[model samples]
Every structure is written in structure tokens, then in C-alpha cells.
Target: MKFGNDRNSSRFRLPPSTAYRQAMRYDDKTLVVVGGSSGLGLATARAFTAGGGRVVIGGRSVERLEQAREVLGDAARTAVIDTGDTASVTRFFEAIEPIDYLFTPAASYTIAPFDHPDEAALASPFDGKFWGQVRCVRAAAPKLARDGAVVLMSGAASARPPKGAALYAAANGAVEAFGRGLAVDLAPVRVNVIAPGTIDGDLWRRRPAQVRAAAFAGQAAGSLVGRPGSEDEIAQAVLFLLTNGFTTGATLFADGGYSLR
Candidate 1:
């Protein structure tokens, strides 16, 4: 089902009053989603667009960006950008004027034991995923409109700290810290972080089936709900944060109790 633009139609229609309220809630708002070509980012873009916001999706791959644009249809805009590069980040932000919402799911990580971690393997993530968010937030702050909100992505690794995932854990930890600090600094702009657990999606599609299954099993074992999360679930959390004006400096976990166990 589609929302916002008339190019697509929704399967379910709301009562006239409810539909009017929903439209008034998000009509004409502009959302910028970095790394929005796939996975959680793409899901978030769809949620915002469905709520009547004009969404702009940014990513490093032109092909993926075009694919995303196709999926989002006319209500969405696309931009090619590498968030790691300061110049590219600058240009992307400059091109958009007075954005009402910004969401970044841009990150990279290396899984390795701390003792023998490859310095080279860490460089890209350290620069792109960790500092990439920093640079994007820095560039986006001035352009964000009053009452605007920014949601950054972190992960369960930041809190879980499993073996052979030292680098990923650290990077996520840094991201959480960045969100906390930025929330204070970007007052009235409503900055927050979403720390999602083992969500069942295509992010690990390249891995072997057995590997994926075992990972899912492990997540089920740890989660109180005994299951992995879905991309749609995480996307809903993003929507909650974006719409809830009172929420800021918060780390909303969509982990299905993975962090508890």
C-alpha cells in the first residue's frame, strides 16, 4: 500500500477524520534518509513517505538509489552520495533546503577478535560508519527546520559485546555516544538513536544458509520473545520517534528483549 502521493494507492482506508488527522500530522514534511537504498533505511523511507512526507533517499550506489526510487515512486527523491566523504556529505545537505526530518542508517563494521584486529579492516568503518554519522549530523544540523528530528542507527552489539565482534561493538558504542551528545547539543531538534537487534532481513543474505540460521537461533535464544525482529518493526520505531515531539536523547531498542538476555 502507498501513501502521500496519488501515484500509488493504499489497501486500507481510514475514516475521514482519522485520514485528515494523519494528513495534517505529516503532510508536506520533507524527510532525508541517508543510506536509504536498502534494509532498515529503505523501510524507514517508506514509512515516512506513507505518512505523506516527501522523502529524499541518499546512498553511494546509483543503481541501488534508482531501485529505491522505483520502490518509493513519485513521493520520493534520490541522491547519490558517499556519507564517508565530507565533500559529498556537504553537497548532499546543501542540495536540500530546510529538511524537516533526517534519518541515517549509514554504517560499516568489521567482526574480529580484539587482539588480532586488522587495522586496515577498521579504517573504513571508523571513518565511514562512525565518523560518517558525525559528519552527516554536523552538516545536517544547520539545514534542519525547527521542531525537526534526527534518528541515527546503532545496534545491539554496542550493549551485547559478543566475542569476535570487538570492532563492531566499539563502533556502535561510539554511535550511541554520538547520539547522546548530539541530542543535548541539537536541542529542540529531537535527536535520538534506534538500537535494533538481530532483525531477520537481507543484510546477511550473502552469508551461507547454515550461518544465517545459526545466527537466528542464537538471537532467539537470547531474546525474551524467542524470535528475531523484522525490518517493519524497526521502521515503526523510527516513525514513533519522528512523530513523538517529547522524545529526545533516547535510545529506543527494537530488539525483542535480546538485550535483556
Candidate 2:
């Protein structure tokens, strides 16, 4: 069930009025999405392209990016970027044109107990999720359109830290703060954060079956909605942040009311 990707596909057709609204929502706009090869990033890229927005997807995996290019069709382009490396991120942005919007979900780090014996493991979240996003935004700042918007990915764990996720919580909290401060410092270039809850997506699907089941069950029990979120749901929230002119420095918790619990 490909949605909004194949324009002629009959399985997921939009109504006339809805189609009209989507036709040119992002016409002449170019969006750069780091970590867009899979999961939430890929879903957002597809949605943007469907709205007539040109998307430049950046990721560390060549094979995954190629796969995403197929899903996005001609409306999107792919680039290689290692968010953990400042030089790779700089080069990735340097090769691209001015961006009308930017959304970064790329991070490579481990989440562990605060009392974990390995010091590096304890510091991994800040190095990857926190600093990695900061680097990408810094590189893309000069190339961003004055009216453009930026959406940084956070997680519901920031607000409601569950067992064994204290470090992860702290990292997400930092991202939210950074989004607020960056919104002010970047002025006219809207900056926002999206803190999503547990999602039934690629990340979870790849885990061991028992582990995945246990995690999902716990997540369902913890959230107000009693279920995990979908990638498309989070993508919609991201689009709203990018297009809403009056929204900036706001943290949208698209967590199925998880944070409220």
C-alpha cells in the first residue's frame, strides 16, 4: 500500500479537494532531510515529494538511499551524509542549493543505563543525537531560506523517562532546548522540535521478536493511546511544523498523549 508515492496508483487516491490542496503546497521548495533513508525520515520525504516539494535525502547508507530514491521517484535526490562527522555533514550541505526546509533525524548512538560501566556508552547519546543534530543545523543554517523552517527530532522519553532510558531522556531534553534556542538565534527561520513516542517502524521491526514484543507491550501500556505511533503520523506533524508560518520554538509532542500519562 504505497501512499502518495505513485501518483497514478489507485490504492491510495486523494479526493479532489484534498488533491488540490496538496498539489502545490511545496511547489518550488526544496527540503533537505538528513537520515532520510528509512523509517520516519523516509516517510516524511515521501510526504514532502507528494506535495510538489523537491527533497534531497541524506544518509550514511548508499543502498538505503538508493532504495528511498525509488520510493520518492524523480521528486527527490539522494546524498551521503554521516551526521556524526562534521566534515561529512559540511560537505553534504555545501554540495546542495539553498534549502526551503530541513528536517534531521539522523543519529547513531547507544542508549544505556546511567550507571553503565562503560563511560563512552554513557556519553554516546550526547555525542550522536545531541551534537549530531547541532552539526547538521549549523552546516545548513547559511543555506536556509529566510522563511524556511527546521524540525529537529526528539522523543517522548525526554518528558517521561521509562526504566533503563535515563540517558536517552536527557539527550532528547537537550534537543528540545536546542530547538528553542536555535529558533531565537536563527530568527525568521523557524525552528521546532518533534518528540514522538514509540513507533511501530523499521527500528522496532529489526529487533529480536521477544524484545520487540515486550517493548511494544510496555509502550502501549504507558501511552495514553495504548498503542505505538506510526511513521506517517509523525511525518504529518513534521509537515505541519515546516509549513505553519506562525509556529516556531514550539515542541510538538506527537506521542499519542504518552507524555501526558
Candidate 3:
């Protein structure tokens, strides 16, 4: 909710007060959002569009892509990109022109306990998120603007995990570590990761209404801020990572102190 951050405008952009007043407009920027059909990715796309940026959302579902396109209107476009598939990823990036930013919030994982976990099961989360990110980066790197950046999605669970979530935690850990290494590898392209705490997003909508409400309440109470995070809050963190030229190889947490709790 706080818009006083430096990403709105930098300190060198005339008076300090003017920076706060300036809207965070992307104008000429082209942002490609993978997994953007819904949830955090879609929210991020909306933020960039509001800032006057052109956005192309990527996902596998034609129906979902159309839904996103309908909601995002003319300022946004959608592509059927299955980031977990090598051929799909290669084709997706191949068809696109150069872009200024890449935001990947795509993820899925099994919830089974770690007791006697199968090798195939162990690999599922990694294949889905960890390697998917790797392939997306590899495919998108050449097309990315030299001065532009990429924002990878990680979770607070990567650092602090509850029971039945170890695999997910590990996968997210790989993403953060990979992002730092990628930032080093890519140099001036500026790669960073966002380790968000639990937010009330589309993923939560799958549960029954009362269950979802109770779960949100529980998570909110556990956080120091006494509330669940909004998707827009996480989107702001994504925007910060993309706009702040000085930041790179950093994992920014917007978890409302959930990690502390």
C-alpha cells in the first residue's frame, strides 16, 4: 500500500518531493509475464499496464489466456506458453520479439508427506518450478533488453517450512539460489527473486469458502502485520525488483514478517 518507494522515480529525477508524486509509468517498456493468466502473475501484469507498459502474458490454457486477455483489455496480450516444457518454452520465446522485463510466478507442487517419498515425486516439484524457471530464463535471455531485468518467484517456505511442505521449500530454495547465480551470470541484466509470504490470491480460491477464510485468518494472525498479504502487495515488490536499477542478485521478502513468526 505504501507508494513512497524509490521505484516510483529515482532520487536524481529532479526534486525529492516530485519523485513521490510521479506515477510509476513504464511507457515504452514491454513486460513479458509467464504464468500470468491468473494469481500473482496476472496481478503483476495489471500493475505494469497501469504504469503504461505493454504486457504479454504467457500460460498453457487457451481459455485462461482468453480470460486474461478479456480482463487486461487491449493493453495486454496472451501466449500459450508451457514453461515446464522445453519445446513449448523454446517456441514461446522464439516467437516473441525482444522485451524489457520478464516476470515468472508460475508454480505447482504435490502436497504429500515426505515419508518414503518416491524419486519421481521428488523430481516433480523441481521439474515444475525449478527447471521451468531455468528453461524460461535460458529461452528469454537473448531476447531480453540488455538493461532490463527478470524477477523470479520464491516463497517464504523456502526459508521456513511447515510439515508436508519440504519438497516445495526445497524447490523454492533452488529458485532463489538459481536467481542469485543467474544475476551473476547475466551481469547487467539484473536478475532478482521475490520471496513472498502467503498472500490471498487465486490459489486460495480453490478451497471451500469457509475453509479458505479460516486459513487466511490463521496465516494472517501468524504474521507480525496481523493480516494476509494482498496480491497487489506482492506485485509492488515485483515492480520494485524490475525498476530499481541498482538492485541485483537480491531476494526481497514481502511476507509481512511471516518468516519472523
Candidate 4:
């Protein structure tokens, strides 16, 4: 929560240059957060707005978009897009101009035992998280600025998925793989993925208070940091992928070293 010098962090420090400076500051830059209605996506959209960037937030919910706009003030813009649907994806991009940075933190995963998975449960995660991002990238590719960069959201589950996430794991894995391949096809337009570990993201907030507390505690015990990741922690990594000019086709882990365990 410190919001310290995230740009100069030891892991992704960049050399001083005009482009580097502009990339770091976001002034006059057009940054889009596809799932910016709430949670980590909104967190990142706020970060960019704070850095003097022009922000347009897209999501499936209108109420959340209004809330985000209220939180972001006049610096933010809003759009509704359900990345799971191809038509929604195409229409969303058509209404927007070229973008300098595109961040897709929109994701939904269904946790279920593979033994008795329902059809909707099996497809919902991929529909939103995996194909959602894929649809966004493909739709926006032609509209991305020459120096544009993209950051896709993957999860630690792709690497060390647990027992109850057979389909979710495959979806995350596909996202990472798609990012790597797209980096080649896109040529200079940078494409990178971030695989976050167990974080207390908004998805968990709807649970009862006691259930939330116990779940967080259990997650904390498994991390190298002895706690779950904060939303700001993941936002820092997202900014790194957005600004670091040299980073492409890379999958950075901000999972508190949980995968190693």
C-alpha cells in the first residue's frame, strides 16, 4: 500500500530515456482497462489517471462503471464490453480510438471438481478470462499505437494449479500461451502477461465476513510473504509491463513465491 517508487523497482528498472520517461509518467497517453469497472482493473485505471493519463474503462456492468467514474473523477471514461462475447468485443473497439497501453485484468474463474463439472461452470471461466482477453487483443491490434504495449492477465493457477481447477488452469495456461504467440505476430507492439498468485481480489469479497477471513488466513500461510497480495502490489506489476519498453512475450509472476512451494 505504500505507492513508493514502483517505476524504479529493482526488478524492472529501466534506463533513463525520453520514451522511458513518457512511458513511466502516462501524461497524454491513452490507457484502457478492459475490466476497469472494479477490482484490480479499476485499481490500475486509477493509477493511470493519477499519473495524468487519459483513461477509458470498459466492463460488463453499468453501475460499476458509474462508481468507477465517480472514483476516478473527470479523468476517466467508460464503456461497456463483455469480452466473452465476440460481438461485444468488436463493437467496444470500434467506438474507441487508437490506444497507447491496453490492460486486460478482467477475469472470472470457476472453481469446481473435475469429477462432476457442469457445462456452464466449465466454460464460464474461459469465456470471460481467456477468450475475453483474446478477443480484446485481436480486436484492438490494428488500433494500437506504434509504441503501444499490452498487458494480459494470467494467474498462478496456470503454473501450479490445485485440484479443484482443472478447467480454470487450462484457461490461464492458454492465455499465457496466446500472449507469447501474439507477441511474435504483432512484431514490435509489446505483449506480456502477468501471473498473479493468491490475492484477496474482489471475487472473494462477496463471501460472508467470517468465511472471507478464514479463506484469507489459509491463503496467507501458503505464501512466501506470509500473506496474500494486495491489489496495489499487482497494479505495480501491471504498470511495469505497460511501461517497460523492452519487455515482451514475458510472463511475470507476482505471486509471493507461492509457485516455488
Clashes of each: 0, 0, 0, 0
Candidate 1 residue runs with Cα over 4 Å from true position: 1-25, 259-261
Number of backbone clashes in candidate 3: 0
**Candidate 4 residue-wise lDDT, 143-224, digit = tens:** 9988899999998889877777888888889989999999899869999999988778786687798978876786677777
Q: Residue by residue across 1-261, what tens digits does model 1's lDDT show?
A: 844655334645545864654554467899899989998999888877777779999999999999999999999999987877899999999998798988999765556566765677755456757888888989999998889999988888788866777777888888888888898998889998898988887686667999889888988998888888998789888878877899998888888784453
The parts of candidate 3 lying over 4 Å away from their true place are: 1-22, 259-261
Per-residue CA lDDT of model 3 for 1-261, tens digit only, reads: 656556546663555643642568899999999999999999999888888899999998999999998888899988898877899999989888898999988766565456645877767778888888899999999999999999998888888776777888889899999999999999889999999877898988976999788867876877889887999989988999999999999999888885453
* Candidates ranked, most accurate by lDDT first: 2, 3, 4, 1
What lDDT does the true structure give each of the candidates? 0.83, 0.92, 0.87, 0.85
lDDT for model 3 comes to: 0.87
Clashes in model 4: which pairs?
A: none
Q: What TM-score does candidate 2 reach?
A: 0.90
Evaluated at residue 114, the lDDT of candidate 2 is: 94
Better of 1 and 2 by TM-score: 2
All candidates' TM-scores? Answer: 0.87, 0.90, 0.89, 0.87
* lDDT of the structure predicted as candidate 4: 0.85
Ranking by TM-score: 2, 3, 1, 4
Show pairs that collide, candidate 2: none
